[model samples]
Target: MTPALLKVQGLRVAFGDKEVVHGIDFDIAPGEKLALVGESGSGKTVTALSLLRLVQNADISGTARFEHDKAGAAARDLLSLPERTLRGIRGKEIAMIFQEPMTALNALYAVGDQIAEVLELHQGLSAQAAHEAAVQLLADTGIPEPARRARAFPHQLSGGQRQRAMIAMALACKPRLLLADEPTTALDVTVRGQILDLLADLQRQHGMAVLLITHDLNLVRRFADRVAVMENGHLVEHGPVATVFGAPRHPYTRRLIDSRPTRDVAPVPVDPAALPVVAASGLRVIYPVPRPGIKGWFTKGEFVAVQGADFRIAPGQTLGVVGESGSGKSTLALAALGLLKHQGQLDVAGRQWAAGGASDRGLRRLMQVVFQDPFSSLSPRMTVEQIVGEGLTVHAPELDVRARRARSLAALADVGLTEDQFPALLERYPHEFSGGQRQRLAIARALIVEPKLLVLDEPTSALDVTIQKQVLGLLQRLQRERGLSYLLITHDVEVIRAMAHQVIVMKDGAILESGPVGRVLDAPVHPYTQKLVAAAAT
Candidate 1:
């Protein structure tokens, strides 16, 4: 067997008096792929960060033995390395690809310049050589028009492109080991697969070990040679991926494996007398964009986000919009919610959206939107009572203050959040709750008004698998109990399969396919839809 490239023993991490990570042991062989799997707050990321001494003010005590690349050099403990020596080892010997490239990359500099800076720092290459090398690295990562994209800033590139750029930067030094922290967590299914393939190819080319930190078990199963399970800083289990996933001894591992979204949605209502809660025909949302070259000064160019989308959500039914990022799924949801200006017929609760204008509180009362990131969506300044009952203040002003407070309490209870589970739940602020709790608060806020139609835009994307399962189950239960109509928008195919009665596949702002979820997903006619399904399967 090849010698272990990285060996961690008796690792412990603590902040002040609180120790998060207990003593844990693990090893990564050269060219091996090791996945550290756990939910949020499980301390997987802290363990990885501690390896490189990147965690600020963290009291990390461990023996992380990293063998030097130079022959005959002594093995060094990475945890005890001097700052200057660690700096030399940081990028040149061990590189990291952070979770969100948007936040990880410097916003002020061009992406190419960022990568070039790494090359110049470690490789000591000339300015022009590093710049050229940066473009080549981007090209190697499969970014289109690499030269042009290199000159673009972080925000200028799409989510996938930005991630690819991060990968390019991480691999520029050909490190012996890579620390990938949730590398594909924010990506769409197809793009996630692309990144995985790119990483695999690059890993093979570099013959480097990878320590993948993620809560996504599917990704771990697909990509990892060995898997280590973490639970609140303890290494619960560790073994080859096949053996561990095939038959797990640990209860936590079993629970995680079984946490995939299950199909438990309410049966579709059948009544000729019933009308769709939300309906749209030829829905088109167009935006004005600046034209390139001299034409931009005089007139703007038209960009159609939702192109003639035709869909309807009958009572107690879910119409799922599935696609990649920027595929117009969210735009369609926005148009349905009366939040975006759109052409063509859109009706909510038997009333046309444009006829009453977007400001019609009555129409707005019939529909509510739950955004993607609950942490950002729920205001930090507002208490739970204020956040949940704010909708009632606008839509149900006739009700007294006491009535509004009662309604907010009821809403929170309905979403499985109560004073029993969380004492003083109503008085607590958003930042006080966990990510899953914050999402529940968002749901409660959307539900306080009792909207007939709920537009959920990637509601559970930010959560761990177990938490995601809990949130999805909550939505399913709410739909069943209230007979609500949902315009669900998401990139998660499994979610669409589990929750949607009817599904629509979109690409480039056009609906490629629409039908029963079974048909669209299992036997997709369009090539693009097929590609999406295949990517999800892999």
Candidate 2:
């Protein structure tokens, strides 16, 4: 058997007095794909970082030995390597593709320049040679118009494009190992498939070992040869991917797999007698593009984010817009909530709302939105009470300060948070809360308005399976009790099966299929819809 390329034993990482990762062990064979699966705060990222000695201002203890393929010499302890020696190994021997490509790439530099930097630093390539190599790498990663895109800044490219650029940069130096963290998290299903296929092809061609960090069990099952499950800072199980997923030993692992939304589980029936909350028709949003000419002119592109889309939700039903990223799922929600410019007819109960109008009191009172990233949506400087009560103060100024405070606390309780927890949390900022708690707080903020319709945009994407299940249950219970309507936008097919009464499959800003959840999900007609379902199932 070929010897392992990297082996880690008893890895522990700590931040000050708190130890986050409690002794984990794993190994990566040459050209093998290994996955670390866990929920947020489970130390998956920390473990990957520990491999590179990148954990800043933290105490890390472990033995990470690297054995070169060509030489049968003694294995080198990576942790004991001097700074200069480790630097030589970092990008030259091992490279990492970070989760958030936007933040990972330098905003100020062109994408080509970033890739060029890696090539120049490691390979000592000249400027022109590096630039040419950068374009070639981009092309190799399946990015179209590589030359033009290479000159574009990170912010100018789409999410998938940015991810491809990151991959290009990482592979430019021809490293022996690749560490990828949620590499396809925000991508659409088609792009995700392409990225995965690309990774597999590259791994085979280059014979490089891969250490993948992700929460998507389906992806792990499909791509990884070996799997390691982590929980509460410990590696609970590790084995072949099929063995671990097919016959999970740990309770946490079993729960994670079972928590995924599936067609077998029936959605709770919602009452139809509740008030008509939100209704929209023929919604279309077009963005202006700059014309390529000397004259200062802009041309309107017919990129309809929500093209002639129509839907209605009673106060108690969840109309799930199921699609990949950039499929106009979020665009539909934004249009209905008057958050973006659109040509559409929208009515909240009896009141008509002007598309993208700012002075629609009825729209504001009738509908509220829960954004995907609670950390960015919630003000980091504001306390929880202030964040939750801000809408109350704006809409119902008649309510005094004390009344608002009481209302905020009540709202917190409605979402399973308590006032006792509030004393510290209320005084603290959003960064202080865990991802699940932050989402709960976001839900509380939306619930405080007591609106008839709530637009939830991928609210559970960042959460663990167990936390997602609880949140979905909470939404269902709230809908039954308070008669709330939900316009749920998500890419998780299981979420649609479990929570949606109706499902609309979208692609390229158009609806490809729409029907009752059971009919569309179980018997999808459109090829795109079928592809999405198939991709999700694996």
Candidate 3:
């Protein structure tokens, strides 16, 4: 057997008085891929961070021995190393690729400058040499226009391109080990596959070990050689990927493997004359961009986000929009919500979005939106009662304080949040609840006004497998009970398969195909749709 490149034993992490990661043991051979799998708050990320001593104010106790490849270099315990020695080894021997590049990367510096900084610090290269190497690194990561992109800031690049640049920086020094935390969770399906492939290729070329921390089981299955299951800070199981996934011994592991989204949505309405909650024809949304060169000095140029699109959501059916990033699915959804001005007709509840009219205020009550991230969407300052009851104030101003409080309680109850499960549920803030519970609160807020339609924007993407399953089940039950129409916008094909009756495929701001979900996904007519399906399968 090959020698272990990294070995960890009896690892524990604690913050203040609360312990997050219990004692755990694992090892990674040279060029091996190890996946630490768990849901939210399961302590998977904490374990990885502890290995690098990156967690601030964290009391970490462990024996993490890293065997360097340099001649006569002794094996060192990472936890006990001196700060100066560790700094020398951080970017040169071991590097990390964070989850969100937008937050992890410095906005002030250009991407190429960031990568060159790493080379200058660890590799002892001159500024001119480092800059050229940075561009080459970006090229190695499969980025187009590498020289030009190196000068762009983090916010200027697309999501996938930003991730590629982050990978470029992490691998600039050719580290022997890489720590990737949820690297592809924020990416679309096609882009996620591309990143995985890129990592595999680079790992093979450099013979480096990878410790991937994520909650995505599908990603683990596709990329990891060995799998370790973590539940509530405890290491439950560890084995080869085939053995673990084929016959998971622990119940938590088994539950995760079985948590793929299942179909349980309400049937489509049979009546042909049923009025649509939202109807759009020739909807076009354009944004003014600064024209390049001297033309920018004269006037602005138009960029069409959504071009001449047509779709409808019936009284009790779901219309799922599937596409890659920058494909304009969210823009289409915004137009339907009357949040953007369009060149075509968009009717919500039998009325158009007029300019500050009384009818528009009433029309807002007919539809409500649930955003992608509940933590950011829900106001942190507001209590549970205030967050859920705020909608009632606008739609039902006739109700007094006592009546509003009563309605809020009922809404919370309808979404499976009660005083029994959560003590002082009304008074507690958003941070007090877990991710799943926070999403349930978001759903409750949307359903309080008794709207005819719900615009669900990537509702379950931020959740893990089992939690995602539970949330989808909740949405299905609510839709069945309330007969709610949904304009679902997501890049997840399996989610579209399970929840949508009708599906529309979009690519580069245009609808490529539209039909029943089963027909379109299983037997796609368009090449782009087929490409999407194939990528998801892998």
Clashes per prediction?
0, 0, 0
Off by over 4 Å in 1: 355-359
Candidate 2 lDDT tens digits, 1-538: 8778998998899999999999888899989999999998899999998888998987989899988645768887888889898998898889999999999999999999999999999999999999999999999999999999999999889888999999999999888999999998877666788899999999898899999999988789879999999998999999998898889999999998887753322344556664467777887888765556754354444456678888777657789998877888887887777778878777678677664445687579778988888888899888998999999887888999899988988898999998576566567788888888899999999999889888899988777777888888888778878878789999888888888888899888898899898899899999989998888776
Q: Rank the candidates by lDDT, best first.
A: 1, 3, 2
Between candidates 2 and 3, name the one with more favorable lDDT: 3
lDDT of candidates 1 onward, in order: 0.93, 0.86, 0.92
Ranking of candidates on TM-score, top first: 3, 1, 2
Candidate 3: tens digits of C-alpha lDDT, residues 1-538: 8768999999999999999988899999989999999998999988988888999999999899999768668878999999898888887899999999999999999999999999999989999999999999999999999999999999999889999999999999999999999999999999999999999999999989999999888889899999999999999999999999999999999998999999998678567686778888999999999999999999999999999999888888999999999999999988888888888888887688987567587788888999999999999999999999999999999999999989999999998999999988899999999998999999999999999999999999999889899998988998899999989999999899989999999988999999889999999999999999998888
Which pairs of residues clash in candidate 3, taking residues 3 or more apart in a chain or in different chains? none
Instruction: List where candidate 3 sits over 4 angstroms from the true fold.
Output: none
C-alpha TM-score for every candidate: 0.98, 0.94, 0.98
Scanning candidate 3 in windows of ten residues, the lowest lDDT window is 266-275
Question: What value does the lDDT take at residue 395 in candidate 1?
Answer: 86
